[model samples]
Target: MTVDLERAAPAAPPAPPRRESRIWLVATAVTAVTVLLIVYPLGRTVLGVFGIGADSTVGRIGEVLTSGETWRLALNTVIAVSVGSVVALMIGAVFAWINERTDARMGFAARMLPLMPMFVPSIASAIGWVFLASPKAGVLNGWLRDVGGWFGLEMVEGPLNIYSWPGLIFAYVLFLTPYAYLTISSGLQSLDPALEEASRDAGAGALATFRRITLPSLRPALGASVLVTVTMGVAIFSIPLVIGTPADIDVLPVRIVHMMTHSYPGDIGGALGLSLLVVAAVGGCWLVQRRMLAANAHATITGRSSAEAAVTLGRWKWVARSAMLLFLLLTSVLPLAGLVLVSLQGFWSAEVRWGHLTFDNYRYLVDNELVWAGLRNSLVLAVVCASVAMAVGVLVTLVLARRRGRVASTVDAIVKVPSTLTHIVVALSFIVAFAGPPFDLAGTYLLLAMAYVVLYVPQATFYATAAYHQVGPQLSEASAVSGAGDGTTVRRILLPLMAPGLIAGWSLVFVLMTGDITASSMLAGTHTPVVGFVILDMWTAAGYPKLAALGVLMTLVSSAVVLLVMTLRDKLLVVR
Candidate 1:
């Protein structure tokens, strides 16, 4: 008995000491780095709002609170977000209903088409819409004129002029409808067909069944979609920056950027102060969403391996197919095809001459120093930044899942701070915090990487946390009790088990960082010229062809990366 006790005791001290310390060390490092990057910048920005600390402004917080323009801007933001969210929800639900209910051959394409905007950078989308809808030199108008002339009718000369609130609404609908579609599609796929069947069997009509059964069952997903779309609509910078700035339309995110960039003497303090207000509002919305979703049960009809059932549309199948096709054409095929055609054509102002087709655009992109440099910089930044972000996410997930202490909870909360704030506010805070510090990390790859990490950590944590929850803690504990040290246990057990979630997290971060425009714009001062900024510059410079090519390249690269990740995840993570 003494000998057995001695052997077990020896295992206890050495095993727990090394393994526990290592886990804590990793957790601390991840938390500390995240705090420095996200927390510090956020703190500085909040302080700047009250005119506290260095570079204090003369204005009081009360004055800002009382400002009429503040309220007006807030109202404007709410209106745009509300309208955009509703429109996107309707479009997404309609398409998702079609994809799930009908036996459409193009359902695959319907799903794939919304994915185009995900590839094309946001600015490129704006540019494509502008070219198609511009009042003076729009291709649509030109085509309309030429077709009308054939009938000897008086042709219109001016452009279509998509430049105001309605124009911005049109653009937001184009981009945000995809989010609605994806979420609603997932919901539609997961819904139990039995409920609808029962409703119909009880003498309910199709529309009645949908209203009484299908819609209510999908309330959670629809709510989540609305909250997400509204949040994005409120924080949208690129759409307004490209279209609204030219039109002199002021929205909240645009106003925030303008404050930072255009304010006299570059009032970083004032900009950050305003940013805090935006952050507070957005944070409130996030908290509200959490509360609403907290109690809702999200039970799916199928497990990971089970394919979702297709609902029979019966007589309305063709109508459903047509709706999905129309959405595909409007959102994906038409815009993307327009981009390719316009890029190939020599001029937007003139009629397309097939003979004018040349490799000049591709050659120009290859030759331009800024374009090449930006591309190279974007790749390196995305690779390095996404790697660090994923690593941080792993640690974050482990701490949130395995550790139950107060310290772990605190760390978890801190990691979520960046997600609540707008990128402009975060940018302002970094400018204030690092401009004159011993730990100043401005204008370096380190700074950009940190920014990307903070920008994406919330999404990574959200997905990873869900994944970790799906993977029970019993496996890790059993491994530990069976003499597996923490490192060995994680390697042999937890990571393999949680591999799907990790891959999903990684894919999400890659897609987000690859196309990130807002934070990258504010953070990539000089050392980093990310793809987003390059798109911005090209659009500004009227290098439409180069921008289009660059946008195409970004879309292709991101999609390939996501696909590869998904494939690897399936092979490794799915428990056979």
Candidate 2:
């Protein structure tokens, strides 16, 4: 008995060192990756901004500061973002109030329908809007002109120019409203109904009750939604590129693209400088938002509150439902239908003739070898990036969960840094860092995949962390007591428990990567084709029919993949 006890004690001492070794190995590996992917690229870009001599970095910064075009582009970006954010806030607030607070018709459908617009890629939405409302050959504009002519008014050829500032703002609002709705609606749903009921019992009118109680209760959520919408407005690339370029309107993002691609010898230095400014502006906004959230931490809902009682709209309910339906029509159904219609037409024109329609666009896409290659590239990039991100996310979560030192905290902060930067900025950094020297990986699918991984790893880590928190440490402790190694415990216990979260993170990253435009446009070359790049090329060449057809194909493929992943996730949860 004494000999056996001594042998078991020796076994326990070795187990701890083995576990410590594995933890150190994983933490070091994750830190190295973060440095390579995030730190090195960003550092290189910042350093490149301070070159020497006639091509001096200081001179470039001075030139950018002195240039009127730079200020003009900045002004245009601010105006568009401000206008779009305001419109989105109003629309989103109303929709959330109606869906969550009021007794509106088809309450469930009203809430679900808004999410449809989210699934349609912003690039696709831009293409669809162009078809429906372009100044020259817009179907709706032409129809409006005809209707006005019947009243003896000589209407303009096409009055709804989708290429103008108003048009751009409209598109931005449509895309951003869903975010506002989701955020505000979540806040409204969580509010304790007793306060609102108490106000009503005191003879307060509906508007008064809302102003004094409901709106104040949702202030934090409203602030957050506003920050998100405005930040997105500034960072958005696809909408501005598609709509602003045709109208000769240049926002900062489009200007960055032009500088990097169109200028003689390419003004890469100027582009990087501009990107730094944008990042600073976005960072400032994020800081302000965080401060606001921290300052306003009052709890409106107690844990004892039951299901929220919906406000009865009475005769106004029909009007509310009509308004909701109209929003859905303008933002979702119309754009989608316009894309389908334009895909069938020989050319985008006001007049629709069945005889002029053909399947040639679809055939062209199907028969083109280049298009096939692009499709394959897109699929492979999405799958590989998502899978790799998930794997990395697991390692990151483990390191974060086990360690609490300053080094661990610093690593956490560095991992989250990329999430705050826009996609365009991240892509520009990659170009400046990896396009030359020891890593001449520009214009390659490998570089493109790396960009996707960097952009999305933070998101996957977020999901994984949440999932990890759901699992208790007791299981791991029990496994350790049973003499299982760290690797064995993770494989047998943690992984099986965290499978659902891993799958969810994978699906989200997959969908985001597949629909991504900014990185694809910035990184892809003739040899490394992607769907977003293909669509942009087609749009520039005025191949509207082919662009629409490609948009439709991408939508279908991404939607199917999302559905499959969701189904798999559901099955995994059920098994667990």
On TM-score, the candidate that comes out on top is: 2
Tens-place lDDT per residue, model 1, 1-576, is: 345534433444444443355865787677677867777766665665656777454374456546788777777777777787788889888777766664553645667665556655666677676766666666666777787789887755643666778888878888788878878887777787766766778999889989988887787787678666766676678888777777766777877666655554465544554565676667676766676577566665643321233456677778877776676666656556656667776566536677887667767778877777777787777767777777777777876676688987788888887665566766666767765577677566676776777877888777777667777888888997999887888788877777788787787677777778877666665456777767766776856666666666676677787888889988885563
RMSD to the true structure for each prediction, in A, is 5.1, 5.1
Report the lDDT tens digits of candidate 2 across residue range 413-530.
Answer: 8887777787888888898778866789979988998899899898888878877887878998999899988888888999899888888778778877888887788888889999
**Model 2 alpha-carbon drift over 4 Å, by segment:** 1-18, 21-24, 50-56, 99-111, 146-156, 185-220, 299-306, 315-324, 470-502, 573-576
- Alpha carbon lDDT of each predicted model: 0.70, 0.81
Q: Best-fitting candidate, measured by lDDT?
A: 2
- How many clashing residue pairs are found in candidate 1? 4
Question: How close to the true structure is residue 62 of candidate 2, measured as C-alpha lDDT?
Answer: 65
How far does residue 441 in candidate 2 sit from its true spot (Å)? 1.0
Error (Å) of candidate 1 at residue 567 is 5.2
Q: State the lDDT at 384 in candidate 2.
A: 92
